[model samples]
Target: MTKAFIIPLLLWANSTYTQTSLNLKPGDTLTYSPRSDKPAWISIQSNEANMVVALFMDGKKVKEQDDSRGIKSVERLYYIPEKGRKYELKIWAKSYIERSKPVKISINESKNVDILKGQFSPDQLVEDLHTFRAIREQVNSGLYVYRSKKQIDSIYQQAETETRNSKTIFDFYKVIARLTGFEGSCHNYTDLPNHASYYLTQKSEYLPVTLKNIDGRLLQDSKGVAMPLGAEILSINGVPAKEMISRLAQYYFSDGFSMPYRETIGFDRGMLDKFYIEFGTHKNYVISYRWNGKVDEVSLPGISLENFKKLQESRHSLSFDKKLMSEKYSLTKEGEGIYRLSLRGFDFAVGQEDPAYKKFSVFLDQMIDTLEKEKIENLIVDLRGNTGGTGAVYEKVFTYLTQRPFRDSHYAYTKFNEVPMGEKLVITPLFLSNGVQDKNGLNAYLKQLYPKAVQGKYYWADDKNPSILPNEKTFKGQLYLLVDQRVASAASHLASLIKSYTNAVVIGKETVGGYYEHNGHLPLVYELPNTGIQTGFSIVHVIQDARNLPDQKKGQGIVPHIEVHQTDQEFLEQTDVYLKKVFEYMKK
Candidate 1:
């Protein structure tokens, strides 16, 4: 799914559309234009099941939806319109259709709507839950990656039982999120509906303190009125710190059996958001903590979202500025023969011709040129907070690091060639514009790309798993890889490649991404019927080209050869403990 699909789903609400009754032939097209600049929900229902709807803004194709599954008669689309911009909705029958039918089209202009307080009956919630389950079972290739079928069924039963008591959309969201997280794929997640998220931002009751988890202990990273920095939190609002962490951890998604990822998310700024969801709004907090050598209690008032942001900026020790966050890669000369390349992220464009990809390619080329000219003997690749991006970008980076030929993955597979639940799936506009408009088009494209792929079975993506030679100017110096819990997806893939094929010394905490295999590649997103909640999961199950090291275990993330974590003093002083370890290792 695209950013437009995900962001608008959380920021907009549904409304009644102007009903229009129409009778058209198979080849005829019906165009509906909105009168205002507000977001609109367009719904088209046909007596037959071959209606294709396309959205055009400023004469450019924005999105296209064609639901010919004959399952649901209505096809819905949501789009936010710009002022003075011309938008048109084009509806037509598929070219293969021989006959035409009566179609009912409606456009609902979205207004200021509050879905936070919206309540659903037991039946409505259950229906949505069933729909969610059906979609996952049919489309998610990694549904049983970590858990057995029996275990998944039992979890679903538990979710259904909990759903019966859910009144608000937020309540159901928790049940769904917990279930999604339990699936153990980092890519799987169910986001709260837009209005509910909006509701959170408007409320003034939120935990003000930022936290850091060092070796399972939650410590205050920010200075509060009564608690000092590095104070160990024993409890909050009478709930034991251990119990609270464990309970809130379930709401976060991580790769199979990886605890560090959940721990990282639990103690970061996400703590405030997850706390509000799990424990509800709080005006004040009774916090018990250990500062220095004594344990004490503190009563602190909750801060608003605005105030929390300000507090994080002023007091949080690990808060990053906008420039730091935006940086993709940086290289610094550490010593006479040592250089540290910090790859913050891998979210560059995949195409070689694209400006982003070209820039990244040039940066790597220059780094290699410098290494050759300066006679740099040691290179440290620091991937501390990288959270993954384009697989091709990582592959490109690996080419410059390794002298031997490498394949991106050992194997990659998906459940289906054609998209399952096409009627309910929210596809990106890029897919549609590239001729994948409906089930048949998707099937044809998949078959063309993966000629050996079969329907209703695991189709190995061999075409995408081709081996390639190393770059001419591959780095030949001694290498060291620095990774932490925040390293995931493509970033972790790079770590896995380096650890597997090269003699690079691996250090720092275990990565959040799987070491051997993970559910990745194409993501399929669906919106729940009742709550309008969007749930997404990656369809491709990727088995990476990794060596079976004793430390790298199954159903776990990339465990470094030398596992190191931040100490209390280092955390408080905002020191790079991993780099300190690297320098310590160099002495030997």
Candidate 2:
């Protein structure tokens, strides 16, 4: 991890060629080239079996650098150019029976490269900035913020320097990681496919069965149709399941997921498009199953990459993902013709002033109007997917539903600062004042003071919450409020309010379970060792009715009145476990 020498030598190729020779196999040489301008990609093609290609340059092994060969697969590509200098190349076979000749290379050419582009998205930049602030706050709040303002000034200066060289969004992801304070969180975090249209694409081929947990060396499939999930894998086009896992591991591990850092956490959610395997070392090539082996060996002329992605999204025989939304979060007519609407995930691409926000507001209004027309029994507001937003347009929504004017009673609390904190913060309750003491005891105080409160516009206090029309009723029918571990922040707030006031049945597992008041903060915070990440700070705390909720660990998440658990059998059975529970409760 040398700082000055962190810059890699770019390898460029002018042309492309598929190897007639099996490069990755044992005893075979695997090598390819890329264009000079972007010198990065390498093609590993060799006749050798289990070809182990290791890149050793200038007496140093470049293992951390991203290259071909799976996560564990050794690659023969160098980030630094060996233009004219002597460099070593090692390509060996697994069994040690086959290997490749060490072809010595020279590095003489040097391209006069100028400033590299700066890359980072607005949210990513804010996240990076927030990181530095957290570290500074923890290390010595006085020295970092109040004393000299050392960290802040330094970060602003560095960001000014880097943005001049960032290129694509990927580059943006990289640049911010390299910024201040991000340390562990900013390592190799790529905000790929965060956009509505852009899906994060893994480099592995999508296998037939959806994988749950790959314990030890055994591979388990959720689609129960297969007895021993691992046993059905059969072959990599008749090659072997174990070999396929090796190829797949490159993708799973390289993702740097499961990292404690906010930025480098793993991405098991996004799946790869497709896989191309040649069994028996290129003697036979077969495309893996896309829809649970429903249609194998895809019958098409020339397999293209676009078609490959389509096959993956087609959920034919897959189990439900825990974080996904299905029937539970839907809008439907009830006995009285009232609407039972369950919302999840911040799927709405709404902005405060944006038309999308207005559009969403209108959608809510329409739902209410429809319920009125249908003369429905009552509205069941299910917020299973509300990961949270500005609550985005909750204000606009409440107006249409509530019958009378209500003042926002929820207080906007915070530890006075220059930034606006988003309501989703882990805060320390400093101004419990006399209110917290009124709670049942110390347990309630811990939940309130240490970190529980939002200083945002998400919730409307009793006064702020509009009153129902004198002629109207409290969602007259049974309001089944569905929630889960995924319900968090604003969603949790809604769940809390629904549970406490309306006495709504909080169904599903515990919520991702967080609630508080906060607003956007941090003009920026930067990570120290981590790159391409910017951070920020904010001030505000959301302290809803804290006495009632459970402690911040096991019971912290909003629990369901009627509980439903995700079963191991569901993966194999492909049953809507949670939904089945929801519907069952609805029927009862």
Top lDDT: which candidate number? 1
Whole-model lDDT per candidate: 0.74, 0.38
The TM-scores, one per candidate, come to: 0.79, 0.44
Q: Over the stretch 50-83, how does candidate 1's per-residue lDDT look in tens digits?
A: 3567989898998898533221234556678777
CA displacement after TM-score superposition, residue 384 of candidate 2 (Å): 2.6
Number of colliding residue pairs in model 2: 112
lDDT tens per residue, model 2, 148-239: 45655676567645544443444444344333222211111222212211222222323433333222122334323233443333344455
Worst 10 residues of 1 by lDDT: 1-10
Candidate 1 pairs with clashing backbones:
10-194, 17-107, 17-108
With candidate 1 superimposed using the best TM-score fit, by how many Å does residue 380's alpha carbon deviate from the native? 0.5
Tell me the deviation in Å of residue 200 in model 1: 5.0
Off by over 4 Å in 2: 1-210, 213-330, 334-339, 345-353, 396-409, 413-416, 419-474, 515-525, 529-539, 545-555, 586-588
